[model samples]
Target: MKKAISLLGWIGVIFTIIALVLTLLTTYHFTYVKYFNDYYTLQWSIFGTMMIWAANMMVFRTNFKNIVYPITCVIIACATMFFMYMKVY
Candidate 1:
């Protein structure tokens, strides 16, 4: 059961990557969603957060790295989005 849960975490990570890629590839084509067009780059950073969000749902074995990984990802994602929001270019 622990292995299965671990597998779920990995699967979530894979799907998150896939979602981010697909979002990047098709974000320009989202003519139906005005918000998406208006928030193009903002959406990209959102995809990063979403990746971590999915990762946070993980229920893996009792390991430090396994636990910290998702939380750390979330923190990084939030920091990135925050910096991006600040228009740090």
Candidate 2:
């Protein structure tokens, strides 16, 4: 069960990276500017979720201090989402 959880966590990280790259590509392409709002929201959510999973992995491994990074990421993500929401709509 632990191995499975770790594997799933890694998969989530990969997906998050892919989503981030896609988000950057979309930003540069600019063809989908109209959909930027949706894309950004999805990207941030994926990233935030990935961070939480990573923090969980640290907890599982007993690396308690390492959890701070993910927690910070989550906070940043929340702030980003709030700013985006205010700016876009």
Candidate 3:
């Protein structure tokens, strides 16, 4: 049986996807004039999504013991962020 993800989780997934895409695009091709790179932005977006899911869990579920979801989110976010950081430049 598959666990159902909430609306906020879906949103977080979407945000992560967009962040990765933007980072890839900015890194390979056209660089935005104002910013040096998009990795920081990617990292922040991932972190933001993780935060959003965390808040959702706290307000709705409030189960600290059942932390698999939130921790997974944070790890994926931070890992992707760091991957971008290491892969880029």
On lDDT, the candidate that comes out on top is 3
Candidate 2 lDDT tens digits, 1-89: 66776677777777677666656667778545444434665556565665656556565755667767666767766766776677642
What lDDT would each prediction earn against the true structure? Answer: 0.55, 0.63, 0.66
What is the per-residue lDDT of model 3 for residues 1-89, given as tens digits with 9 covering 90 to 100?
A: 01233576677779778777767777777654334255676676677777677656655655667677767766776776677768743
TM-score of each: 0.39, 0.51, 0.52
What is the lDDT ranking, best to worst?
3, 2, 1
**lDDT of candidate model 3 versus the reference:** 0.66
Which 10-residue span in candidate 3 carries the lowest summed lDDT?
A: 1-10
Residue 50 displacement (Å), model 1? 8.8
As for model 1, its CA RMSD to the true structure in angstroms is 5.8
Tell me each candidate's RMSD, in Å, in order: 5.8, 3.9, 6.3
Q: State in Å the error of residue 17, model 3.
A: 1.8
Estimate, for each residue in 1-87, the C-alpha lDDT of model 1 and write its tens digit. 656655655665675565555555556674343333334445454545555454544553266657666666677677767766776
Candidate 2's C-alpha runs over 4 A off are 30-38, 41-48, 51-55, 63-89
Q: Could you tell me which residue pairs clash in candidate 1?
A: none
